[model samples]
Target: MKFSKAEIDAVIAASPRTNLPLSKLVLSEERQVRPQGSTPKLSVAELAASIKDSGVLQNLIVVKGARGLYEVCAGGRRLEALTVLAQADDIPENYPVPVLIVPTDKALIASLAENVFHIPMHPADEYAAFARLIGAGKSVEDVAAAFGVTPLVVKRRMKLAAVSPRLMAQFREGQIGLDCLMVLASCDDHVRQEQVWNGMPSWNRRPAYLGQLLTQGEIESDTDPVARYVTLKAYEKAGGTLRRDLFSDDDKKAYLLDTALLESLATAKLQKKAQQIAAQGWKWVEVRARYVFEEFVKFGELRKTRRAPSGEEAAAIASLQSRLETLRARMDALQDHEGDDDNDDREFLKLDAEGEPLEAQLKALQESLCVWPPELMTQAGCVVFVGSKGTAEVKCGLVRPDDRNGVAEVARKASEVDGDGESLVSLPSAKTRPVHSEKLTRRLTAHRVAAVQAELTVRPDVALVALTAQLAHSIFRDDARGYHRPETVFAITAADCQSDLPTAAEDLQARILDVVTEAVDANAASPLAALKKADAANGAEQTVAATGWLPACLRTRREAGMATEETLQDAPERAASEALAA
Candidate 1:
């Protein structure tokens, strides 16, 4: 019996399964169900490994072709892998591949059925499956090898599977997203994870803030200077616990749970540094984990006098500089030759490695020459504090206020002997510039705005003229360039004012109604529409320039005791309003 491609039900339902020699299988043209020029879904090597680990679990669909060969219409990728294994001698040349035989006319339909009808497993289900395999005592590496994925992938899936069951159910139900799920998985405390998830409102459950909530009490090793100084390796050696973030691409990023231990280590290191600085004959040396500006501001600072380098030191500096220069020249040359060439890259890296230590050694030699005089060291003190980059920093030549005068007196006495006196050395002075920072200037301007608002509230005349000028500028100015900005802070959003009753006084309302009624009557009664209306329009236009006339809304609100016409005439904005009218 023959079957056509359109007969999917018959072809898929009753296809006979058989084994065919790997050598007799050929890929058919209709097997390309994926889009043209698209990358293959699975790596051929990975597929071959999977097939080698566990023989083909899914049978390929094929049709009998010319020359007694079976043409693979579906599972072409598997056929490719099998062919590769056979060519590599990993599998026998005549190895039998399991396949389902369908009619030649049903080839395309069979291919479509295999490719189109295949549904991928959900991520949550995959994570659970991996967990089950681990529970079944399969190693992560073994599972990765069997699945053609890296061990990291398997471990990540296992971590996701470790999330709270309630949260995972939410994830499966689409209540929680994969990103938030991964964040919750960062912490292994299932109870804490559930508490955080349940405590947060839907709107506030972002991944970043969720991570912050989870690590609220923990110190970040990546940012905390003390952690950087003590180093994660040392902290671990000291038996401190670290909470690693699996979601973080950087494995080195973690949270130090024991902050007290971190501080203790940092303090001990700083103390050891302080002891070395004290041995230089300073009266006192204090060690602080962090630098506090307010605590050190009370003491006077001394400047360092740089002495010339010694003969041996100068020669060493020269040698290091020469070596560094040579390394830099080599690095620059290697950079131009950098590309697919691995040798040039290795040479560049080697030069860089050689240059860094030489540069550091040269800098240390230069800085060591700048020393506090022995006369000044006895009068001043030293402070060893941790700098922002987590390096130990020393602040020397800090004389107390009482000690400052005593040192000045000693210098005065010494000046009497030699008659050439040394000036009291002071800390570096700031370059002359704007005294107020941008932030402070903004704050001061804000206070001035408040003050101006208070005074402006009582001055209605000034407010009216200002508002009139502002509106006039907006309406009549040429500001297409967008350079003009309204000076007033007021937001003027216009809306239609609807009312059942007239807003003006009753007498004023009656007069306006009479005038409008008269104009309508005249226009209707006259044989020719009256030229009187044009005369009125001319007079109104003239009135604008003649009397500086403004609409009542545009007119300034006068103070109770103030004379309106005189003040309006004298106002600069009123003049501007007149010019606009003209």
Candidate 2:
């Protein structure tokens, strides 16, 4: 291990520097000791002249083998030169090239190390050497020091050695670079590593790009064999166009129009539209009124009417007659209550002023009913004729010839006066019928109930109350403007009333009154308006209470536990104190 230069020189001098005869040399057993560099072409004339003039300056390094044969380690070119000279009869045919005997393994290592120091070896040779060192149990540090590199570099070289033979062949053939191989080595997953290695186009594989590919899954991983195979096949079928159009402009458009994406957009749009419709219901009484009007139009046409109505119509007429009778009784009661004094007289006058319009309207209705013709009566059809006497009739089949003539005469008279009342006497087309209570009841089922409930859950305040009320008015009111049957309207009102005042009936009643008054002013249906106002009042109170500054008494009670009532009414407080003590 410590051989000096003199000792090495002495050994070299004693060792015969000659090539044994070709017949004696065991050519078949010769092993490649060192890889050859690219040989420069020399002309035969030049080679021959140089061989004759200078002979071979360097002796071939060989190890002694069996039967006096030699294995060439280095200086193969010099050996070849001598062989050529002998063939041309320029030198002795049996002449031998210089030979120095050493252990075969030592010669191989020395020759390789020497050549590696002087000139570059193929990557394959470097990888093999690293592998040999590792297999010999040499530490990475030892190998690094021997190769004049850091241990990291040694480790990288060792990794190259561990790479699959196929990949190594690629490296050796210069199909891939060391940088790319380093990338493959860094991969923790073997399958992923292999996939990345294989996926790389022969020209594009680079160490820097490998990190990106691994992080992004741009390159298929080898760890998941099945996934890797599937991905690889897909990639191949796609013509290996990776990373070329990954972030192209068209993908953004595709994402925008994707079915799931479009569905989400549509859902948002519908929700917004529904909210708008609900908000409109809250803002405009006319909208609800119009909806009710349309419903009534589907059932019956309004027309001026006279006497003889069916049993159902007669029942409705009787109800209206009773209401008018009650109004008359109230008016007579006001008359009798008058006093002799002047102030009392003035109060009576005010009462009379209010009663005049009521009396006129009732008297007019009475006269209209008294004069209404029986021939004008028919079943409910396009026109519902409500007699001023409170009877109802529908126009059945076609208009009678006499009734038609009468309507025409009325129209002609109204036209002569240029009166707008011409439309009132005209008969509507047949087919329309009064919307029956039973039909209205059938329409108000559990489906509507659920829809209203869902709406309240989203907006649980006055807005919901207003919306439900408007819906009630549409479904229940009796006038052509009121589509809802009375019963259905009552049911909805009850439910809403219950919702508004779940715990306090009196509070609910007050809120309803307030809402109705406000609604009446807003031109909304009285019942619905009342509910909306009640909800608004409650909401306002809640808003004020939530945001208002605390009163001093309440603040003191909270902060100091001082009850205001304790100091007031000391006699009662003393009694309470004595009771507690007792």
Candidate 3:
């Protein structure tokens, strides 16, 4: 049978009123005892304040007990707050606490209903509330205290509230996840936030991607080598600002915004470090943002041999060890009580910080005992750079090719006569070649080729054979350098082989500066300045086709060879020949 609307309403209200009428009764611990369950903890401070300001807003459900007492089956949190006020004498002992009297059997159902149906306010409401509180001139700390949450939490709410209203609405509608809202709220610009949202493809709207999108052009302070070298405070002092991630603990998400400032700071620090190294009597020092390990392999590193520590040094080390042991014992003992007391933890950390520098100093002193000879040090210098580990690294006693003084022949002579160190006397050599100075090499080769051409007429058979061989090679082989101009050739006789090519410049001048230096200083045409650097980039660049002027292959078969002017300068005799004669 169909029922009228009024009849339906009557049927609904006909049942016993579960929401009973509220009445005030004497407050007592013996009566209306609070129930227990695994429930979310209430903020007693906040609740207590509310109760003090306005007496209980909700009626506590109670059950009758023996001796005119009542047991609280529901609204335990309200009872707890009321109890706190009563204990503090803010409320009278027999304070009239408003409650709803119910039967004992139905108390469990009432308690479960009260707890299970209680839904927390949406996060959007929380954000709005926090925003309203802030707009009303309440500080972050004040709002935090009122809400019983951290200042960071209150700030986060305010930030979320500040995001684009559209995005916030989407978040409220459950269209946006917490992570999405959090990352989107990184920037204060609502317009930018909306732009990022619109620009982002639906498939890649992940939190990490959104965070990176928001923080583009910003360098993570912790990961930046410059920031690691210079503290964040120092960067600020040098005029840099950091954007901190509120969601991150301990401000670990700091990002350095002023890149130019960071670079300047890094350069200044590197220059200072370089000056300090140069003060150590190094001939030169270089400063670079990064030093590659590959470059170190190109240079010859002097082997370091340790000298025995003196009595004073040994005693100092022993004393430091004793102190370290004592400190370590104390630290271990303190570690047992760590976090028990703040002061104890501070002391433990302080000792820990102190121990590291001392240990480092000891290690450095021990390392210092090992020495490269002062002579070697004077001949060579070092390079200073910020390594990947965010510390200054000094590579010492690396001798440049130009720094090599004695000739191999002189060293060989000295070793034969007696096992003394290599004599510093210069000897003639043709090993060094001018790969970079192509024009200079061509000129030198031209002179030698002219001489060879004039001499070829007397040695007709050798000339004919050499011309035939050159033709065969030129026709058969695909040499990129083209046919070596026969006019520049310096022919060699099989009976008397020429060990040294005549076209080379002085032994030192023939040595090409590192092509790295050549490319870098190429415009300057001052290879001498870059002679100090042994760069791996130069080695890689040098791996090009071995193209150079060779006079032997460039000589021509000429008829009338003798020149009008025939004068020659006498060459110096070999030192070994002179020594044998004596």
Runs of candidate 3 with Cα error greater than 4 angstroms are: 1-35, 42-55, 63-66, 85-96, 100-119, 191-209, 270-272, 288-381, 397-582
Which candidate should be chosen as best, given TM-score against the real structure? 1
Predictions in order: lDDT = 0.72, 0.46, 0.62
User: How far out, in Å, is residue 206 in model 3?
Assistant: 4.4
Candidate 2 residue-pair clash tally: 23
Q: How well does candidate 2 score on lDDT at residue 165?
A: 71
Alpha-carbon RMSD, each predicted model: 19.6, 34.5, 19.7
lDDT of 1 by residue, 16-120 (tens): 988989999988876556543343656777788789889998999888889898888788888888988898898998998999998877677778877766898
TM-score of each: 0.59, 0.21, 0.50
**Of 1 and 2, the candidate ranking higher by lDDT:** 1
How high a TM-score does candidate 3 get? Answer: 0.50
lDDT value for model 3 = 0.62
Which model, 1 or 3, shows the larger lDDT?
1
Could you tell me the lDDT of residue 3 within candidate 3? 41
Query: What is the descending lDDT order?
Result: 1, 3, 2
